[model samples]
Target: MEETRSQVDWLTRAVEALPDEMTFDAMQQLILSMVFLRQVSDVPEGEAQGRPTWEELVGQVAGKPDLVHQPVQRALRAWSGSYGKFRIDLDNEAVLGQMRSDSRVVDRALRDLIALLDRAGRAGAKGDLYDQCLARFSEDRVGGDYYTPRDVVRTMVGLMAPAPGDEVYDPACGSAGLLTEAARYVETHGGRPADRTGPVLRLFGQDINARTRSIAAMNLILHGLEDTLPRDIGTDNSLLHGSDAGEKYSVVLANPPFSMRMPLTDAGFVFWRYGPPPKSKADLAWVQHVLGALKADGRAAILLPNGAAFRGGAERRIRAGLLYDDVVAAVIQLPSGLFSHTRVPACLWVFSKSKRAHAATRVLFINAQDTGVQVSRGRRTLTGADAERIASTFNSWSKHDAADVPGWCRTVALEEVEAADFDLQPARYVAPVAAETAPGEDERRVRELTEELYEHFAEASRLEHELRDVLGT
Candidate 1:
């Protein structure tokens, strides 16, 4: 999918043919319908488990066009927080309502989409189909947080290094990129990425938005994660209404909203594993959530705003608590413009429930803010080299043979962090660099140096004359 231009694929073209303003909800549901149809087509007839097959729907369409929505409606059984049981409203003229008016055009579009799916097969190998579906959503209908840059996601996944039989989760899984990367990690470690059944691997997610929740679930489906389709993901507020309360996971990766000042009403909520955050920002609240959700040995990588580290009062308490418990593993400051919507830069905070065995005495701090290249006019991203460098630095420190680089990375002892009042900011821990001057600063410096030398010579001559007078020469 060439994202630089509108794709000519049948999915994009068919979606473009939808009627009216083409809302976000409608587009997500429509894509879900297509994905469901594809999944149904792939399963064996006897093993469909009461799901409808795409060929069956096509057969009904061939017989009577008036009953276009009937077959799909019947095939779609309502599940909790899913497309309503008994039927999905596919014929309300909002999305497919124009099907009644321009039946021929709509039929042609649907058939073209089906033909395209058949030619390419139903399930994508890895992130292929999910990426295409996201590309389609990128046209005009996605409403949520900025998508995590692919390289950043890759780097985070590498740092966590999820293993086989690990249970991976992302709480604010806007696009499910973190879990997708986790799935990839499982495959790299001699496991299956598409294995949805238990014991091998498990992927979990929770989102506040209903539409984005649906999109996340469908994204997993397209990525060939069929067993993870109807797992623990739900459309509920992770801060207020939490999920997976007592179930700790093996790996957790997340990019929660930075400034969603969670209301302070939940001082008694069960989600407050590290107590409650301030009434202003939810940054540390998300941190506490991740920390609490981790199994005793689980490791997590979180992308958070810079404020969460050094903010005073309530945030300071959270930081101090984490440091005291020795769960704060490492912090990596990222480059600016990683997210286009906001100007605030972000950093990666890695936490391990049991760090005493590995990085027991010190917390690794990496300053990678200057390593990214400006790929676009305003967006700065980490190149493959940059990612490798950062990830390597983390691994080196984790293994206790870290090579310290000035202005790049530094390891500080836990006692030092406690002395600094638990300031987890990378700038506080990393070494400083000498001030760098601009192009013309050297010329001005040279001139100033010459003038100072002439003045010193004059003063020396005056001193010589005074000495001659004293000697009566």
Candidate 2:
């Protein structure tokens, strides 16, 4: 506990010391250097481990037993040379002046420090220490941006319920969060954590960004999956390399980037069979990729933008093909602003390769757009209760009872789906419950007109305020 607390304090200090204009890479280097300084030092006998003096530790590494106050000078010089930068005397005011003039030197030093620490971490020297360093990195860098919250990850994993012997994969594994959650689920279900090896050996991921791949590897290691057998496979530019084809998985979970465009050639010709998706939207292509990667008994849960459900043209054809296969099991509509980066409402498309007794020819539609609570201004999240409600709804659907909760969830037949031009938008089919009737139509019309007039008055007032501000009133 002392070591953990010390490491945390060191990380906090290092991050705090970084320049405000520091690039992400530079911040990474600074954090890595601090981690190394905290972990890779010799301990004196009979000394308490809590809060060892940095000066004493640096002096021991430099072999200058008598130069306690001068340890920073030697440490600076040693780190400079290791990072491929010119050495400087920390105690020399003139040298420090010269060092501050060259920005390239600082960048090089930072890069070297990070590279050295990354190499050491991957070399099996101190796995737990390395993971703590990575946790700090994730906290500082990712925070709540572009990555799912940890609680949401846990909820998704619970709903998926990957068994110890199940093969799990995430095609767009951002930071490998889903993979780690799946591993945790296996352990909590009475399976030995080490059993995450052979069955977990089937873990795979692909990302288009190199830095994200590194983050994924670090995340997996931090989650006690460092020793899992068959090793996790991850690669950057995976789609471009065409490496994920012909591979299948027992379970897949992903939140792919929304509405991004990809060339048909880049996705390979095989996706064309589902009918070519529009060039400007690659949502259907991603759907096809997930479908192709699923084994005969596989299941998938994918997050998609609102456009994927009711879009016309090629996307409609792809939707039709999926329905034809009876692979779609459920569609859960999520609230807008649930993602940190975008305000576009999203949905979860759940698919199963083989139809269970309750899932045959029936699609469970959940209108959860109003389910989550607000986490920040204009941002919302599904609490544990909300997730449980949705999961229970799904569980009920899987048990063959048509869950017919008005305005919340319902089971749609394939015939109705075909009648709607294969549109999968949840709101189109599920009707909301009725409220008590008003006294008369004329009274209701007067009330509606009064509300419209108030809206116009409010808009006029807002415009007047804006004009006054612009005129410096």
The candidate maximizing TM-score is 1
lDDT of 2 by residue, 58-159 (tens): 435346333322343444334332111112111222232333345444444433433344333443334345455555565455243325655456556666
TM-score per candidate:
0.74, 0.69
lDDT of 2: 0.63
RMSD of 2: 10.0
Give model 2's TM-score versus the native structure: 0.69
- The local lDDT score (0 to 100) that residue 157 gets in candidate 1 is 86
* Model 2 CA lDDT for position 186: 80
Q: After superposition, how far is residue 173 of candidate 1 from its true place, in Å?
A: 2.4
The residue ranges of model 1 lying beyond 4 angstroms of the native Cα positions read 1-15, 39-94, 98-127, 135-143, 193-199, 228-230, 234-236, 271-275, 418-421, 431-473
Q: RMSD for each model, in Å, please? A: 15.5, 10.0
Off by over 4 Å in 2: 1-15, 28-146, 196-201, 229-232, 236-245, 431-473
Model 1: colliding residue pairs: 78-84, 78-85, 93-97
Best by lDDT: 1
TM-score of 1: 0.74
